[model samples]
Target: MQTVVQAAAWAQTLGLPRLEAQVLLLHALGRAPHDRAWLLAHSDDALDTAVQATFATNTQRRLNTEPVAYITGQKEFFGLTLHVDHRVLDPRADTETLVEWALSCLADTPSPEVVDLGTGSGAIALALKHSRPDAQVCAVDASADALSVASANAKRLALPVDFHHGSWLAPLNGCTFDAIVSNPPYVASDDAHLAALKHEPLSALASGVDGLDDIRTIVRQAAQHLKPNGWLLLEHGYDQSHAVQTLLGNQGFVNVQSRPDLAGILRCTGGQWPTVK
Candidate 1:
């Protein structure tokens, strides 16, 4: 029988990153993924035969490019532990840039109304609600399956984010929000990156030819749903900031600009609806 350390070492031998190997092993051992210190303390503890087998299986899943969060069935985003699966796109840390931006925009407004469009796992909406409990947060998704996953996260986290099922900005007609945020699919349908992301839901990864279809739709519809002086923030492809800024400008949004992610890439862009006219 392999020991805890041995199992982790064995998976790394198969080309898995050290972090991925440790997470998978911890998962197989029924331990918290973040419990790396436990692994070191029990490094020499022998794994049960069943646990070793499970570790090997999870190792192969990683080799196949499956996301570690999906295998472990949870991911930590914006200081929250969220349950995730293939039914929804795995939440990325970079998307937190958009959430932070939204929070900053709403900081001065008491009990601000906010909506997260394309809330795959309700990460954005939930994070906003957790940070600003007084804020009224709503989330919308086009896929019912996605909504199920998002809502479950909300229920588990005890964050009362209102969820709606419909295309972007469609379900809440006649309702206006202080801010609207989204991380819509911005990958070109023909982009080679899709091959690496095959494990994720296709509809959540790709847009039209230029990959701006969903962004265009949201920018067009957001004006109608946003309160005067409200903000519309979006997480988009690495190189699409200029195009996104232009779209927002054409929509008559003011204060258009982009924010860099942790890596300093302009990964999110936003603008404010004019308070006048």
Candidate 2:
């Protein structure tokens, strides 16, 4: 005797974000996630017992602070619907800043070779491959489970990307890329925000105490792997631009610059690896 209208109203009473509640409800009802307008048009429609039970379960999960993307098992990033779960961190729209900057760096180069380090869900690598089919794309990650998720995404999207199983820049011996990018773990070990991200894999969300451990690793090693004039783009915490820019400069990167995200926060930093350096 449960109805979609009643369920939606109950969700509102719980103070759940309208979009998250509807997404969970629609997923429970086996409807498309984008069909929010459909729900509005048919709000009065009744749902069967089984559908109601399923929706209730999802609503409770959301109430417990589970991410809507994790509940739905999919996140849209850079025009691609990426399947995500606990095995990988949910791709964030903010990370698209790195992808956009990477594309700009490779715009004039023909058949540019690109590598995404610590590619959690293959989001960055796949988006680069999808947008520039002529470019050769490679994704490297240390977690086998994460690699499996990313590999599946690449296959499902029919995007050809070389998948490597190892830590950042480890497996690509003697291989150089025209552009290297990553949205590595930039959250500090003591950052208060880690509590909110409890469900995500910590290895993919936190680095050393300063949160720049991995960035240091990537910047230090990039000089050897990057072709002359190659670019390295990374997404970091909003307040770490100055620190990251200094790291890039210390590593011999020139024309270093930080790009502002949609919120005007300098969330991404990049620089060119000059041949003379």
TM per model? 0.99, 0.98
Query: Tens digits of per-residue lDDT for model 1 on 122-232?
Result: 999999999999999999999999999999999999999999999999999999999999999999999999988868999998999999999999999999999999999
lDDT of 2 by residue, 62-155 (tens): 8888888889899999999999999999898988888888998899999999999999899999999999999999999999999999999999
- Candidate 1's C-alpha runs over 4 A off are none
Best by lDDT: 1
The lDDT per prediction is: 0.94, 0.92
RMSD of each: 0.7, 1.0
Instruction: Say which candidate scores most in TM-score.
Output: 1
TM-score of 1: 0.99
